[model samples]
Target: MSKPPLIFAVVVVIIAVLATQRYMQKRRQDAVNDASPVRTLQAEVSAKREFPAPNRRSRQREVIAAEEMRYEVYFRPLSGGAEMMFALPEKTYHDMDKGMRGELSVQGTRFVDFRPDAAK
Candidate 1:
């Protein structure tokens, strides 16, 4: 009934509403992702490059930055099309060589799985 308690109650209600909205948004994204089918294609690594993560090291503090690597690929779908270019992680981008063939399984922006040409 007091002003302070009413303000506190209102803040709590606002937080609860925000949490519920986040939960619903996540659920909807998951549903849409699930409904979308995974697609696979025969692809090859046309190019590869290693990019050093930006260093923000300060003399006042010693900091370590994560190592991130990327690659560009020419994806030729089994159905056939112009080579598509994309970048992916280097750790998972193993044994990358020009014209290194492989099969790529992908969902949205994430790489689901990749197998080297030798495996085929």
Candidate 2:
């Protein structure tokens, strides 16, 4: 092949690679955006995961992790509609269980509060 044709082919390959990367990234973002609500009362603590300590060195000079044992709460999807599981905290995870079923609050994928069934 001629030098000009070879150079053009290389450029085309580079463009194709870049386009593919962009498309994949968009697809990943869409997956997150499509998720409406990842939490429901019926959701149970499917699993517990350990997380590293939070960065307390902030401008506020405050702390988030009070205990050495940090955990992430994983909620089982309800009716498989959401298809997205979320994590919060150890306290939140323990608050919700199979026996309890009620309102569960989540703030930015973190468990805020869990209201158990009053009837139960």
Candidate 3:
């Protein structure tokens, strides 16, 4: 190949390598950023006794009766005026009824984006 052409080819290869390196570096930085813990708000319901966990999954419509009973709930904010009840998955009604306070931390999506039953 001609001298100028060879030089141009070498320059193109160097540019491509630098670009790839930069892209990889940015990807690593992004992963680190994503792994960092996100901030969230907390609140408590003092009036109630314990938060109820429905027998059925939230996807299925199940009516929770107010007259039956109610419980104090500590929750993070959810969409609209609603909030999610934070509790143990394996807990029973009596366990939930024990009247106590709790704490929670949420991340990723906005508090407003959370659903009424979005606890895990």
User: What are the per-model numbers of colliding residue pairs?
Assistant: 0, 0, 5
State, as a TM-score between 0 and 1, how close model 1 is to the true structure. Answer: 0.48
lDDT of model 3, residue 96: 33
lDDT per residue (tens digit) for residues 46-103 in model 1: 6665555444553333334644434555565656666565566676656566667778
Give the TM-score of each candidate. 0.48, 0.37, 0.30
lDDT of each: 0.66, 0.58, 0.46
Look at candidate 1 and give me any clashing residue pairs: none
In candidate 1, position 13 carries an lDDT of: 97
| Native-to-model Cα distance after best TM-score fit, residue 58 in candidate 2, in Å | 21
Name the 10 consecutive residues with the lowest summed lDDT in model 1: 55-64
Better of 1 and 2 by lDDT: 1
The residue-level lDDT of candidate 3 at 62 comes to: 45
Q: Of 1 and 3, which scores higher on TM-score?
A: 1
Q: Rank the models by TM-score, top first.
A: 1, 2, 3
Candidate 2 regions with alpha-carbon error over 4 angstroms: 1-41, 50-67, 82-90, 98-100
Residue-by-residue lDDT tens digits, candidate 2, 1-120: 646778899999999999999999888766665564544455555565665555565434344456444556555545554522555556665655543445666543445466665773
- Residue 35, candidate 2: alpha-carbon lDDT: 64
